[model samples]
Target: MGRRRTGEYFSLDDAIIQGQIVRVRCGACRRAANFLPEDLAAVYGGSRFALEPLFPCSKCGTTDFVRVTTYSPEIADFGRITLRRPGPKKLVQTWENETFTERSRSNYVPDGDFRF
Candidate 1:
């Protein structure tokens, strides 16, 4: 869907910022949720805009679920933005990378042979 002019989304003509309460629905399970303008703005940088409502999987639905929304200023196009709480995978990858680097460091020797 196309985004409307930034002014259309805001009520106060002089207010630089404005937002609306919106209902979001899960594309997979169709579970719906309400999000306040402030929360939406916080996720999208608090500007007048329209965004695609992305929802979480039923199994992963929670207050911490990720949201992919967008925002556009008066003369610009809405850009995609993501709101997410890091998941287990992110933690695991971080730990794994750290461990790998540590192991490599431990195995290195000051005079280890080097070749072009």
Candidate 2:
């Protein structure tokens, strides 16, 4: 009924490398934005699965987001081919389409680049 959870698309480290941005909406105001990894790291000290323990909306001071997702359209479209998450535009307006690149976004090395 909503955007898929983080675990559905990626493991913790995979989120960091592949998540171009995180899309989240305020529970009370319905305000939403595309947050880059740097933005989330500033708030949660990490990018993966960090939206929990909800923080207040800077605009409304509400301590919750109604929905969240790793929003990358190119990946989403590609994911659908493999039955992963739906495209970002199908659910959110703030997410921009990630242009197709031949390089695999699945460069999730278990030990070299990410710890977990």
Instruction: Encode model 1's per-residue lDDT on 1-116: one tens digit a residue.
Output: 22345345542221224343344545555555545545545455445343444334566564344332222333332342232332354222122334555467776556444433
Model 1 root-mean-square deviation: 13.4
Per-residue lDDT of 103 in model 2: 62
lDDT of 2 by residue, 1-116 (tens): 23445555443244456655556677688776655555556445563463443356778776655566655557445534222233444323243456667764665346543321
Worst 10 residues of 2 by lDDT: 79-88
The C-alpha stretches of model 1 lying farther than 4 A from their native spots are 1-19, 54-93, 96-116
Pairs that collide in candidate 1 are none
- Which regions of candidate 2 deviate over 4 angstroms? 1-3, 6-13, 75-116
Question: lDDT for each of the candidates?
Answer: 0.41, 0.52
Alpha carbon deviation, residue 27, candidate 2 (Å) = 3.4
lDDT of 2: 0.52
How many pairs in model 2 have backbone atoms within 3 A of each other, for residues 3 or more apart or on separate chains, i.e. clashes?
A: 0
- What are the TM-scores, per candidate, against the unseen true structure? 0.32, 0.43
